[model samples]
Target: MSHPSMDDMNLNAPHSMGTTIIGVTYDGGVVLGADSRTSTGVYVANRCSDKITQLTDNVYVCRSGSAADSQVVSDYVRHFLHQHTIQLGQPATVKVAANLIRLLSYGNKNMLQTGLIVGGWDKYEGGKIYGVPLGGTVIEAPFAIGGSGSSYLYGFFDQAWREGMTKDEAEKLVVKAVSLAIARDGASGGVVRTVVINSEGVKRNFYAGDTLPLWHEELEPQNSLLDILAAGGDGPAPMNE
Candidate 1:
């Protein structure tokens, strides 16, 4: 019997990436978050970036580093999952997804540099989160944050994450973690893109503008020098001022 061709196997071309991506797990499901900023070295190339991507009905993928490279890895993973489901007659599990990434990286070891986070419910593991580094190494954690802010966000997650936490609580922690990362990491800024993966599928939400707590609400009322000058403030101002 002749085996199906690659295309006949349901695999397609890969996609690329652009920015920072993170993930965390909770009781009901897992949450993936990413910054909407794309940069190379110190130069910011784009502001409205989105790393979080929906791979399947309930599976989600995100990545960081070389926007172009990351996108390819993500697209490849998505295609692999679809093909696996078609060929195996079942949804791709976290382990399979992780292994596929590793194999791809091994195939092009020196040429690829992309960190990824794959999160969703596994048929056997229930809720699962896997962080795959550039070389396809896999790591499991209650929470995982990738990209330039990986270290900073991991610190926050380490402090906030707890076993048996509810999905809502985990979501809040993820937001906080991303907010902190954006504040500290220059390449990781802009809006926070979050996705929740569960039995109900993936739910995406975007928190744009000055929504993160890093912005000071009280400082909003502070008067600018222009405003003060416009008021003709000279010499000694009033005691109230």
Candidate 2:
């Protein structure tokens, strides 16, 4: 009997998740968002996977990279935070949950293939956003973006993100950014999901693919090469055509 090589086995694994995840802090709280596509090789394994995970009643995480790795990290952090909350007789802070993820990610950096953004509201800090990147580095920022799609968004965020944005504005920015990523990044698509947390509570929102406004090339008319050829050498067909 012949057996498959390690490379063949690895190629068949379906837990990879190339994605777009965002975290933005507003005056009152924070908004965490993610795209819903989980890919395996060039195949889309799941079109509507939930990448945002709840770490606590007030804290949520935007997961990227390998879906299995991120899910396990979130599970470990959630378990630890639950114990910590029981010991302290109060909810765990956003920093605590983020640090827990950072520690786990860093400790197993070589074995783990995931990056995460942690966002939440707490009594002490009000609203907070933290980035736990692939190497286990943790950075607190007013706004953060990650995953494959983030490569297309640095300039946009710099131009669009602002301080003291209201809750609505922050949520709008998150949704808009995720939609933009979905348009440009082949690895990012499906729907957009967001978690908004603040002193009031946590709110979840979902935006379907058909509902998101198209942008740039997406807004252009769909014309195939065959259509151009069929135009009888008219150079190019009009967009409306």
Candidate 3:
């Protein structure tokens, strides 16, 4: 058997979003959230790549998996949706957008590598969330999560997700979930970004890393090392810790 060359392996490696993306429905609207890490194998290609993509005025998608595949899917979906809206003379509903994604994902399952969560508010349905995972399966969910960090979050969501939550509560949950995942999952990191869509309009929020709540050992002080080092003298220049 001929072993693959290093160049062959490098060329075939996909740029992936080993991510934490979420779609949550609240009392009045839906919120989509995601971490911003894009990686190629073990190397981080982009520290802050926006995984949440806007599909229309209200509809948005949280993309996870091969970055290129997800981007191309989103782009195609966006164009199709634009035509859909023009023909209908109204904004496309959340279901329409999700189904389009499902069609593309499923039809090209053999060639594509991506999992998407679609979330938005429609005049008819009020608020909705859909999970389109690998192989083109579409599942409507109250709240949907995907990507590498999702394994760590299944239990967390079971305990934390509830019906009729207020908008603020849902947003808080998303931020907290991403932060917890960041602490545990090596592939998910960077800031958290969220999109809220409702009867009124769409709103976007950005949370910096420093502002997020620390979890587990992250909350513990590293004072032991710093204090020991400082014990001798002036202490390296009083590091940030």
Candidate 4:
């Protein structure tokens, strides 16, 4: 039997789908999380996909969509960052990274498609995180979720994220967000990959199935909207309207 080349891998496989979630802390830092599942069609081919990567001492990246595509994109970004730093005599900026990704995606538009989240602090800009799609659109947000399970993760982030959450809070949210995504999205499962980028540096950890922490306690289901309205008791809409 002969092994297949890189070109032989099917980029359109259902299991190839990936998702990532990133949260920016109030004090100017970021936390990112991704699942460790790679699939072929409807079947899971690998359960430990490493989708989070470091581009520089200060910069980190999380990506999703087409494992092969992501690998290529990540490698290119890392290389570009390093080369750009040497050429410009400074650390690569978010704009530079985004532009590099845009150029690469444009060249291999047919073979690869990747969504990247770049986060870190800049000398002049303080802390920042930008999500860049394959089509070159870049946007900033306090928190951003991408990939198949993004919807579920976004819901968790939207409600739990606050203006000044601490590093610990950010870490907990990353774990909870990825766990929720895994539960709701079939293509996302297995271990959870967590990465923290702060003023000091970037730290990464992996949580396997048994080691993963419980996000929210198992609660008896209830009507949340009705409960909220009941709690408010129709009190003049709480002003500031």
Question: What TM-score goes with each of the models?
Answer: 0.78, 0.86, 0.86, 0.77
**Local distance difference test, each candidate:** 0.73, 0.91, 0.92, 0.73
Better of 3 and 4 by lDDT: 3
Ranking by lDDT: 3, 2, 1, 4
Query: Per-residue alpha-carbon lDDT of model 1 for 112-222, expressed as tens digits?
Result: 878878888876887788887777678876677778777665555667788888878877877777777777766677788889888777788888737778543223223
Point out the worst 10-residue segment of candidate 4 by lDDT. 214-223
Residue-level error in angstroms, candidate 4, position 165: 1.5
Can you write out model 2's per-residue Cα lDDT over 21-126, one digit (the tens) per residue?
9999999999999999998776677889999999899899999998989999999999999999999999999999999999999999999999999999999999
Superposed by TM-score, candidate 4 places the C-alpha of residue 131 at a distance from the truth, in angstroms, of 0.9
Clashes of each: 8, 0, 0, 1
Using TM-score as the yardstick, the better of models 1 and 4 is 1
Q: Where is the poorest 10-residue window by lDDT in model 2?
A: 219-228
Residue range 1-241, candidate 4, lDDT tens digits? 9976545765445547555545465566777778888778666787787777777777777878877777778787898789889998988776576567777876777776777777776666656777876665677887777888886766567778887777788878888778777767777877888877776777888887556654555333334465478887554465675
Q: Quote model 2's TM-score.
A: 0.86
Given candidate 1, what's the lDDT at residue 133?
Answer: 79
Where model 1 places Cα greater than 4 Å from the true spot, the runs are 1-19, 215-241
The alpha-carbon root-mean-square deviation between model 4 and the true structure, to one decimal in Å, is: 15.3
Candidate 4 C-alpha error for residue 216, in Å? 9.6
